[model samples]
Target: MIITTSTAGRCPTCGAATVSVDDAEPWCAGCEWNLDAYDRQRRAPEFGWAWVDRWSHRLGYRLTRRQFTHLAGRPLGTGGRSAAAMVTAGVSVLLIGAVLALAVTGVWLIVAFPFPNVAVLLGVALLGLAVALRPRFGRLDPELEVLSADRAPELFALVDEVAAAIGTPRPQVIGVNGDLNAYATAVGLRRRRVLCLGLPWWGALSPPERVALLGHELGHFGNGDPRRMVLTQPAFTMLGSAADLVRPVDTVAGGGIIEMIGEALGKAFQWMLSRLLFGVHLVLVAVALRDSQRAEYLADEMSARVAGIDAATSLLDTALGHESVALAVRREMRAGHGPGRWRSAVAESRAAAGGRLSLLRQLSVREESSLFSSHPPSGLRRRMLAERPRHDPLVVLTEERAARIDAELAKEYEQIRRAVAWSG
Candidate 1:
């Protein structure tokens, strides 16, 4: 489906060996020839702000080189998500200081309970501080329809199998929503791992491909993505808060020169704070980007290992196929079909595509390359997968078993279909 290290082709530019990933195109690892040809935006000759763009482009260019040089070729086996010391230390100071302050406030409020005025004010302050600095134990999104084992035993069993194969803990909650994607996350104070499947996507995938999806998603927790870590994730959230707090503010001046000067000074101070925040953000992000990309590669490997190379690559093809597949979803929304015929709809759309799918996929690949994209370009990912050794699927979903899952989610899909139809 993706990345292969076969040297059957030759690179015209360097006379170096060319590798074909997914058989779409042959590219050279030495020069990264056609792989970057898709990044049209990066190759643009002009920009609205030329000077700023030139500098930014240089930075991006450096980052892209750093990415492939550090990340390419071999399997990235659970490259753990890493955080910058600056971010880690800085977030720790803020949260720990806030916690300590809250503790002190609590003790003060308790001791001063004998005094009416002070106690009342301190008590109010305690509640406010506690709320403000509270641990961000993320909450489950209410939009999801929670599915217990009793409701969807076959589906839950599949999850258990995938988790076991990936060597990760089974998600405590499995839910579904009417969306085009799936995700794995930890939610609530106890940090219950949750898998929220998007019905449209779930319905599109083959049984083995679904296992690949599970492998990649569940791999997030095992790969040590700092964003998924309950302890460090809150700290990352606090950084966003700090950035917003220091964000630049526009100042309006009254008629007087003195007032104008005062406004200018205020604006300057705000700008300085904003710039400092930007610097912190830039540094922290640069540090985190490497780890994040590494984690993605590792997750893909887990997917390949758990569900076989072909299935994993086909699953990744969903990235390429999403736009084409959206037509099916839209058609379903328009038709208001109960129980949502995803497999048939998806097949119909792909069949209509004829020869255009590859071109569309290439265009999509070009459009997705960015300095800050969370995942590596799907094309590059495919190539990486091709280069790595292939693996046989560890978990397989038989047709009859898949049918059982479809039956279990039938009512939910029907309701979702009606809702989508009405909303449209």
Candidate 2:
């Protein structure tokens, strides 16, 4: 049966009336089955400040952005640079102050105690425990194959060209090894940039769309989003440890009535402190998410400029089917296939899924739009791009250049495929 926007057939599993949400893919309303809704529900919060955290951030982000725009005499959607900076700075002050108060109190408890030696020992141990509880930001993925400009000049050259087109600095480090996703991360205290491209994702794209994809990533660099994360990221990490800071720590039972009462009071104080820290962390995260979404929109604008609106939008359209493409590749590999069939696998997957747009529409049905998401919904992005004014191309990719760049990365495709083999 021919399917139109409003006409969704009954569920195959359970024959019942189908319904669609937000013009997304249809599902059996009677059976309460919808693919997109299922995906959203899976990711949705079950309990504990999840809903509160997301909505708080949404509200805080909107309020801050609107106020900043008004004060700066800038149009809404111009950029989130100033507001994010302000929020980060303000949050840092509050966090620092809280840390200092805790430190001073800890010191006072040790020095003024009746048994100063025992108090000092306990205080030192507690300090050590707090430090130990801090989050480890070490390398989690050791399998990531790092690429250098010297080794992959063609890939690096493409990066440089895209950066130049978008007027941003090229990332210092490049890594290959992901399924169908590309991301940028800030490294070290200086926040040196590293760009990681997933080969399977890259291999599936046409030459022009590759430029669009790169442009979108480069746009994040231009937006200073990852770099700005340096402050808030660590603060959020420290806040995570605040729970341990205030946890009801039990001590030796034979300490006496005074010691027992002291322990009880201390436990209550720590609990209160933990709750306060949690509240602060939620507010900061919400504020950050607002700026994060703006960064995405700004990046999209940059992608449109560098790769043209059609290419930029099409890249997003293809991204919806990335998981499907990755799955197909994994299936082939398990059957003793090699890297040669990577592109063919992607093609077959897309064909079986009824093309990129159709797959995207299906995915969007369950892609519940949330402020907590770093990026805006794919459907909204498409609409935003369509409404944006057309501009001259910032970087134009000739067919030959695109093919040549692909040839350069051709050698690394096998390595990336093997690395991702275990990922799925």
Candidate 3:
């Protein structure tokens, strides 16, 4: 079965009817030929470390497997806030208290010394570091082409509709960038919702699929992850910064005995702090993994309800094909022809991927469904969608509306295309 240009065609392999959507090559429903065409490589994402990554892969598989099994049997619901959320809130409080304690200790040290001394100098350093490590209130990036409701009424309207459908408030801030991803987060002290759309992926999707993307992200508002919680989010950032500050610097040998001893002490202090931060980070992230993955499933289900199962499935498949998009951008950019041809180049790359896509997806499932991963494997996600009750798309994207939306985004897309192409 072979289908191209969103048209049905006969599958050469099994003579099965192949249906194509949104100009992508069709997969035969009968023989499942070209099913892997969305996946271009048989390689899974990695940490690029040999032994550590090997161990991580195993651990991630085990954790995801167990969690998936549980999710499969049980109903999918985030339910009320759990005790883990309370624990994370407690951690956030302790982190803030630690900063206050540091400030107090610094002041006490300076006052008790009452003269020029190492104690005074140490106090000053502590004060500076404590201030430096203060939790930063997140702000939307100024460099992004932020689109206000007036600037992109059509886009904002779509977001509003999706938000309403999903029972979440529309994001307070919306911006576009060149990455092959998108995210919705509650940012800042006020926890104002912010949504950022990555142009590469946006350009690749069909209209209903875009709805699915929005549904999946905005759905996070109702099914919150502890990491995204206002209190814990800042704590996570503060801990990461603290870890970076305490990370040891390499020392050259052949220094004086005193210097050597001082360096050793410094290294020991760094090692202790680093390990403490690592342990805390591990616990926080590990505890959140199950919930996070479950949230992904819930979000996907929401997406299907609003965007239809087929559209959501297509979106997931395209997500798995981002490597194809990335590769195409790189290939065309290097040849000095990618500035405006990125979308076409991506189409070519996907076509070239052909049979390898399925294998790539299979390999990626392990990586994508890992304990450390933010989401479950696309394969499992699609399977879950298929097993669930089907729903008609609530918001239909007519060709005319899609065209209008594209027209509105034309300027931004032009600039974004060049940026993504050249940056590749």
Candidate 4:
């Protein structure tokens, strides 16, 4: 609960002791300086007990710091035995062994059968080459930004306020030059960072809505499980690469001579290796993604705990509204040969909408058939949000109250869209 002081205090700017709530701007009688600003700047420090209360209230479920640390920092493993590090090391050893075996076998086969064995060697070489080059093609540039001087003040202040309220460390704030979206990286050796992108539509979000979003990101940071995600990312990448390579092989082979030849010539070895790797990847991804959805749910709860569930819920409504508008614009642009400016607007609109919708879906849905989906179902998130108590403070910050914020955002998004359309 937030505490407000009933007694008037002296204003620092005006050096006036006589200041009351009755005054229009709460200025000091002696000096014309704004007392409200002074009070805000010089508010009394929060009590320790208050922090304890806030944290206890916010984290409805009992979780120890040790458990949080373990969840957030645990390494991925294979078959409940070898960790990701161990698996990586094991893969390296297997790769070396395979290379040695190929070299020895290739030389023998070339000496014995010449042509067929030579062809087999070439195929294996090409396959291995593709696997090695896969990383180069698949690298994803960090969609997140490192915080800069310009954004530091506002973003940091917001983080500090929210973090203090929730009794957690303020996460590092990063900006992305993308559509309306933000995500929190786990606490690393470096500070935890919350990445936000520049979305014209985001400008339309009310302060409460924005705070709710921030709260969600903070939830991820506080969970401290982002590190585990970071650790497991490589496994995901490898699995994806292997899957990509295998699909073409499976298509070409149709379980026939090519498959038989490949299998005889260590293609079977590679396939077995890939399957093992993929199995581990699948397990890690499932756990990580499930944890991610949980993080979102926890964040929603935390946001409600701090700002009120209503605020968080309204924020979702606004997000959905923005997505709907953006999608409409994209459909229009696709139909017409819109200008270059409109193209970016259309792209951004789609991204903002899509990202939020994806997040919402992830939170709501329990089962997903898509292997590539990184988030839970939105319907589930909405349901969870809806289930919270009506008296929740966040609920008080209704969607109806967010109209002006939404309008401002819509106008900005539309401006970009119109500019692009006109140019096109």
Write candidate 2's Cα lDDT for 246-298 as tens digits: 66666668788998888888888888888887767655665666667667767
Give a tens-digit lDDT track for model 3, residues 31-121: 6565444221333545555665556666776676666666674457645655555666787788888888888888888889967899998
Off by over 4 Å in 3: 1-51, 82-87, 105-126, 250-256, 327-360, 420-424
- What's the best-to-worst order under TM-score? 3, 1, 2, 4
lDDT tens digits, residue span 189-292, model 1: 67789899998788777777888899999898788665576555545555445556656676554588888887788777877887776566555555555556
Per-prediction RMSD in angstroms?
6.4, 6.8, 7.8, 20.2
lDDT per residue for candidate 4 within 1-424, as digits (tens), equals 1112224666666554643331222444444343213122222322236554334322311221122334332221112422433454454345445545656554555455556666667655755544452322122236544555453455555656667766656655555433545565543423445555444334434556666776666666665342334443444455555655553253344587886776666766667777776666565554444444445556766676666766677666555555454554455544552223333454455465553443333322222212223443344445466665544442233444344433433434454455546665
Residue 385 lDDT (model 4) = 61
Sort every candidate by lDDT, greatest first.
3, 1, 2, 4
Q: Which is the winner by TM-score between candidate 1 and candidate 4?
A: 1
TM-score for candidate 2, residues paired by index: 0.72
Report, for every candidate in turn, its global Cα lDDT versus the true structure. 0.70, 0.65, 0.72, 0.47
On lDDT, the candidate that comes out on top is: 3
Which of 1 and 3 is ahead in TM-score? Answer: 3
Better of 2 and 4 by TM-score: 2
Q: Model 2: residues >4 Å from true position, as ranges?
A: 1-18, 21-43, 46-85, 97-141, 248-272, 332-341, 344-366, 419-424
